[model samples]
Target chain A: MCKKPLIDLHDDKLFITFEGELTLYTIANIEKALAYVKTYSFNALQLDFQDVTFLDTAGALFIYNLEKYFTKKEIAVTLLLEDTTQKDTLNLIKENMKSSHKSVPRKQKSFLEQTGELFYNYYIGLLSFLHFFGKLFTTNLRYITSLKNIRFKEIAFEINESAIRALGIIALTSFLIGLVVAYQSAYQLKIYGANIFIVDMLGISIFRELAPLITAIVIAGRSGSAYAAQIGAMKITQELDAMKTMGFEPFAFLVLPRIIALVITMPILIFVADMMAMLGGLIVANIDLNITMELFMDRFSEVIAAKHFYVGIVKGPFFAFLIAAIGIYRGLKVKDDTQSIGFNTTKSVVESIFAVIVCDAVFSIAFTNLGI
Target chain B: MEFIKVRDVRTVLGDKIVHDGLNLTINEGEIYGLLGPSGCGKTTLLREMVLLQEFTSGSIELLGKRLETISERDAQSLRHQWGVLFQFGALFSSLTLKENVALPLIEYTELSEKMIDEIVRFKINLVGLKTEDANLYPSEISGGMRKKAGLARALAMDPKLLFLDEPTSGLDPISAREFDSLILKLRDMLGLTIVMVSHDLQSIYDTLDKVAIIDNKKIIYEGTLQEVTNVKNDFIESFFGKMK
Candidate 1:
């Protein structure tokens, strides 16, 4: 039942009475009445609880706080609890409040202890990641040996969703990047009458770095977030729980398709990216330097060797594996709240981007050592 | 004084007219039930009262203040004067039960942390939940417990009027009866004026002092439960005659 808890000023004393539940449900009404009472001057305030059918800790705390407030303002507040149960409940809550407050300090961890806890959690996180990697590696090896058991349709759909759908964005961004690079370089190269060298720069940069890095970054943002969010939702809704109970492996059904799809498609997406980038460079070369498409192609083929293209494509599957693994890991980390899905998704994106860059750096070192 | 006065209320949602020329009055300290079949706009009426839903044409008053024509600040201030228990406990999943109850106090009041903690502990307990439940998130608790926690959240502001949207639908029979008695006790003790949307015949009969039933987007019957039962009509016959 909802009734406004009210207060009346009578005989220089304010009398507060609750006509409804004093719980959080009706707290606003009680607060409204208190706000009204606070405006007027009174010698004392009294609370009448004879009509109060229910009295709990919340109601008791309200009275106690009201009492403390009035006392601070040089006004005396009295509580009238005619019901024995109401009085007992109030007293019990008052006692428990003190005890609960006291328990806080005893339970609170020390500064060093809290620091140790932070480190301990990170340690556990690293171990969990290693364990996840081991399980995924073993599962993939097992599934690969029995390749006939894999779901090709699901893999095709994943490729369509994660990789094929991403081609548009990748093409657009890479073309623009190539155009920007060629335009910026043409001006500097033209100053030294070395405009023809722009082809060599575009070819090396786009093939050996830009195409692979841009494609990986784009896919990480697109498909990585989706994988994390999808799995996270499944986790929160307990669909993953249901799958586990039914003896369905989430790794094989969910993770495997996504990974297989990304692995197969990443290189194709990179190859497309390379074509778009070179086309953008070729257009800029023709427009800015008066170089014909034939001349541009001839110079590009001479300047950019096949090894540069090979270096970019070679990094695709590794980048794909890293992105998929990070997304799947973050998704699994999502706990009870929908908030965790958001948090994990963002973390997955950031982590995958970092991992991709780190992988690219390693590739750069290895390729340089081999003189590719 | 008339606590709630609705005049010439008209509402149309999407392609359907939910209510037309609807009028109702709710007096102070009277437990009123809005009863109807599913999709009859029982909950819609409650939402309109709380200003969550807007009507096409109507003048609605709460605590002698016009609801439709109020300043945004005044409207927000007015929200503090009443409580709403949603069909499901819409407790913030990120916040624990205690934090959920304390949210309003923290938002609206300048009470000390100690006071809020005490109140949070007390409200959850009043609803028959233990102190341990305070640390538990909504998902961690049972459906019935979540309902109670929702009620606790609604009560956090100590609203005069409690708006309930089928408070007993998902509970077990015993729990439903317990919830009913809890409402009755709150009514008797605090003199609460309750407006609830309910399909449960037992809840309507047990807890409501007055009732209004809607059918075909109109109030088919408006009276005490006994009076409605006495009125012989096809819908009434089909409605109450079968509940027994």
Candidate 2:
């Protein structure tokens, strides 16, 4: 609001009236209004607060200072506040004028300084992440060593929610992945009359890489974000605080169950993904490349070894650990705001997906070097 | 001057009609309170007054301008004339109290950094909060302090009119009384025309100059606080408990 308080100079009396609400918000406008006051020199000043609509402590202080300034000049100052409802607040402000804290100005940081601050925040985030993992590992080891506080029911529920409930989407995506790989690879193999080799391609690709990759990606989107949001919501509502006050370890009670569920589910999901993807490839190979199911099975058994399937399922629990860990970690990162829940959920899903891909690439390099 | 004038205002919420032929005028330098049962749309009527929602039919002229026909520029300009304090304070959770109060100043004016800082401090102090609390986030503060911060944010623009929703519902008796007096002081000093929706009997009895009680899809009672409480109604009796 650029509305400066209007000062109307009348015959033998200076009537300074304020228009609109007089509060800290109007302080800038009030300053401009004061400048309007400073320009005039009247021996007798009558400050009429009759026209002011709303007055608070700031408005009171302004009027008080204005009066003080005039009284200092030996000018007659008449404060007519009889018309305003803020007379009491004005009185209170007048009483407290001596004690009002003079606000100190904080220095503004340069762009480079702000950027350095961000790096510090990032460093803190990394250290906290390491601390969280360390706590989780020790708690998990303690639980393993002592079976007394094991929450079997919660782990079962977690498995049901994050794994059993995720079966449909996982099966669908894995099947599609297999279908896509077989169809694309058959196009190249078919041009050279090597359509029979589609079985080897589908079997090895689906079992070794495609199944585990698609399964991990699906879980990352579904269960990973869910864990983050669930834990974040709990954190926001102070349930985590209540648990800590009651001498309950959040890691043992909350985190371990989800971890156990994810670890158990991941290997099983990979196996399911392997079956579905191979099934999808079989369907695609039979339809697109004119290869019989019998011939496909024969080449599959001969060309693809059992160790290929083991290679895929073996990485499942590790990927699951990465997904669940990041999800819960991001969940714990959620602060007091509602928006942070959504933000942490997104971050968890993204980080889990990235971790999965990075782990897959590492496996690729290692497996290639080892000739597996 | 009539700060807000509503005529033939009909607001339909889904299948139910909330305001049927609603006509009211809020004058300048007055404290108007809205009273109703739990689901009687007291807050909704306040929203209607603020143009947070428009009536299904009829006209509302705020600050001598019809809200329905107002342009975007006019609406944004008109926003400076009034400010609303939502029930939950609705302070930006991420911003500290001072930053929240300074938001409107930064957005609406070209006031210098120093002026903005001083103004923010003043506003926070005006709400009876210490200037030191300005640096604390809303979550770090107590509920009373949060409400005060919200009040500071609402007063950031220093509009001619102010709207409040349940200003004292969560406050204890003393805090509520203090808040009521703060309202009185604001109204007296600034001469602000304010409309508030409140369920607190003490707030209703002590603070407001005028009352509008909505029931049966309309404002059944409208008068000075003395006149409305004098009415013989079962709902009013139960809600206010035969106002002392």
Candidate 3:
């Protein structure tokens, strides 16, 4: 099934029907659905798997995590399994939880220690998606409110000084990126006797990957470092503490604004980078493959699907979110002195770039499998 | 009324004991000095008062309420009642002096721009900075000026209690004395209860109504400067001995 039938119940009963291949990709959606279900006022959840056609380790783990979560909430989970494989998977999860629960000595651990361990594990397990979502929403709220209060002139100055200074470098990087993608794709296209198709290849590649990735990297270096150093230095100096002492949440005032500014500006920058890189590819394609601009445009239209645009746009905010988060996180984590300011700034840029790449990879895999 | 009370406060960082069974009280409008040499846990005690540093044991009561028992929001609310001048005047370099001073006022109040600007200018001028200096960034200012600017930012909220750590450490002798005067003036003018950590003997004598001396991980002396000076102990004597 392309979409799972959502179960709505007044009581604690959760009924879910999944159809299609149950891989890690599909399993994540199911897990999200379960989490959404949990947020409702419910005491018991009964999951129905009557329409689910496939089962895998990924799907099993998804169910297991949900089960563990529900067990902690003291909510009973009843698995309605029609298939033997599904039953076996449920049994495996139940047995695993039982064994692990038994392993921890209840008497040896203090209540706080056990609670701390539980919370830490819960946090780590939900970190990738849940944490990002929380950060994104809360950070957006924080930034919006901070932006409203601050002098608009200061924000303009920051944007002009910090973001505008890096615009040229971003353009240069995106231009070179387009040229590289065109140059690389041209060789393979030439071997296939479709040398003119290099335009199509570069257009799609840049729109779908290189432009967004390059722009994100540029931002990671430029804006991310700026954000880190600004806040990191604030933290180093005790301005962050001063803000708190004055009854202002640092995350709301400091991190929130930068995160908001980055998220708002990054996608626009990516769009700009996309257009410029596409032009770069056009120039290279005309010189290397002798394709006219008109022909190149026609070929790009024919070959570049809407899915490419969807994928590119989808990753923009994700990259923006990641860079802003890593920058702010490293900044806030800074302890003592000017040395940590410099160190965390470097770490923010490096980690932001690495996170952008990894996120791009995951999105690629997810989109490719989803046929988006 | 005593604005802040610390009872049997102890702090351990890993295997190291930072503070052991320390107790103190600061009345309203008193400039209480925590005088100690380096590594005597003065800063640690200061951090505990702000709730930035957790204590291993004991209770910190600010405004007659226990700190650890308060909710996070309440703790934050209580913390907001004080302005802190960290050792370095940790002004947000990204913000101009005006903006740095305006931070607390902006965060806690819904005052109009004219109002905020007025308050910012008032605090800046209170610390003896020119209004032209308000447009300059913290880095653009001198070290002593930065410290004054930090104090201005702290005072922007019109705090009831003020915490200052080494407000005079790196300043010239003149600037240090001036800062001490500012502290005395603030305490007098605003009736601010001040908690400060300093090794500067001149500042101690200039501002503090009472002093708490930390030696060997615990408070060895808790009294006025004259009381601490009269103590025949070598460390206390020698600590004040350099003044003459």
Minimal lDDT window, size 10, model 1 chain B: B86-95
Q: Which candidate is the best by lDDT?
A: 1
Stretches of model 3 off by over 4 angstroms after superposition: A1-165, B229-234, B241-244
Question: What is the lDDT, from 0 to 100, of the residue A369 in candidate 1?
Answer: 92
Query: What are the per-residue Cα lDDT tens digits for candidate 3 across A43-112?
Result: 8877666767877777777767766788899988887668898778767866776777555445688899
Identify the CAPRI category of the predicted complex in candidate 3: acceptable
Task: Write model 2 residue lDDT over B1-244, tens digit each, in one string.
Answer: 8888878888898788888887778898889988888888887777776656677988989898897787755665677777777766766664688987897787568999999999998898898999888899878988888888888877887878888989998888899999999999999988888899998888888889888888877777888876665777877778766555
Report the C-alpha lDDT of model 1 over A7-46, residue by residue, as the tens digit: 6778898777776566756665677756867889889878
TM-score of 2: 0.51
Query: Per TM-score, what order, best first?
Result: 3, 1, 2
Comparing chain B with the reference, what is the TM-score for each candidate? 0.96, 0.96, 0.96
- The per-prediction i-RMS, to one decimal, reads 16.5, 16.9, 1.8
lDDT of 2 by residue, A1-372 (tens): 336666777765687766667788887667865775666767788877766778878878888888889899888888777654689888887788778787888989999999998999999999999999999987888778877678887799999999999999999988888889888998999899988988878888888888899999999999999999988987775455423322245787689999999999999999999999899899988999888889888888899999899899989999999999999999999988999999999999999999999999999889879998
TM-score for chain B in model 1? 0.96
Judged by DockQ relative to the true structure, which candidate is superior, 1 or 3? Answer: 3
Native-referenced Cα lDDT, model 3: 0.80
**CA lDDT of B117 in candidate 1?**
92
For candidate 2, give the lDDT of residue A208: 84
> For model 3, what is the error of residue B226's alpha carbon versus the real structure, in angstroms, after optimal superposition?
3.1
lDDT of each residue in B95-137, candidate 1, tens digit only: 7999878877976689999999999888888788899878998
Error of 2 at B41 (Å): 43
